[model samples]
Target: MNWIILIIAGLFETGFATCLGKAQETEGRESLYWWFGFGSCLFVSMFLMYKSISGENAIPIGTAYAVWTGIGAVGGVLAGIFIFSEPATFWRIFFVITLIASVVGLKAVSS
Candidate 1:
């Protein structure tokens, strides 16, 4: 399903974002791994985004893009807290929840 593929793309968006952070944190052979990881994830994310927006599903471009970025933003924040030990402030969690709700709302209203 297109929705499923969109969700996968969003997850890959999260992957690339987190990998980017890891890549920035160090240098040399280990950083190379993160860079490669970021590249692979970015490729898949874009590929799936294309699939979801094109062909039969034909979701509106703006809608698809918003949902994709919404997922990435929320997932990235969670990853920052859990994986990177970033502060888990109340306002941050509240906004993340709202973003998630918006993503779901878009999906529910879509054809």
Candidate 2:
């Protein structure tokens, strides 16, 4: 259950980050919506992270956190390119793959 929460938190981390990018492009009334969405996701992610760490030891928690961060970062980059017209390059994909592999390795060793 805790692990599930942690995973959900990770997904929310991605959501908040993507919302932040979108919010940056807005100005008036619409900006408030994006800001509020980002804030809510951020708060939830942090709360879930706290719950997850409390339920697990530091090593596993930390491992899960690192993987979650990797997922968020990669997901953010992809979102930026697809949704915001940011550049998508082979190098970017390569780095994302590397990050994913690192996450997998971290999880394997920690488990």
Candidate 3:
């Protein structure tokens, strides 16, 4: 359950990152919506992550933080390509796969 919560929190990290990108692309008042979305995601993501790493079942901080950011980095890149039409070059895909492997490896070895 903690792991699941951690993963979900990581996904929300992706959400906030994408929202930031969206906000950057907007102009003036139009960016407010994206900003609001970013803030919402940020809060939820951080709260969930904090919960996952807190209390008795708390994950090791180093491992937890790495996995959280790894998910966010990979998810953000995928979102950039799929949602924002960013380039899907060979190197990008390769790195993404590598990141996924690393994250999964960390998860597998964690417990």
Best candidate according to TM-score = 1
- Across 73-99, the per-residue lDDT of candidate 1 in tens digits comes to 998999999989999999999999999
Candidate 2 lDDT, 6-106, residue by residue in tens: 76888889889988998999999898999999999999988887777774453366676887787788778888889999888899989988988997787
lDDT of each: 0.95, 0.82, 0.94
Q: State the lDDT of candidate 3 residue by residue for 34-65, as single tens digits.
A: 99999999999999999989987888888899
Clashing pairs in 2: none
Report residue 20 deviation for candidate 3 (angstroms): 0.6
Q: Could you tell which candidate, 1 or 2, scores higher by lDDT?
A: 1
How well does model 1 score by local distance difference test? 0.95
Q: Which stretches of candidate 2 lie over 4 Å from their true place?
A: 56-59
lDDT of 3 at 13: 99
Order of candidate numbers by lDDT, starting with the best:
1, 3, 2
Model 1 spans with C-alpha error above 4 angstroms: none
Q: What's the TM-score of each model vs. the native? A: 0.97, 0.87, 0.94
Worst 10 residues of 3 by lDDT: 54-63
Model 1: ten consecutive residues of lowest lDDT: 54-63
Best by lDDT: 1
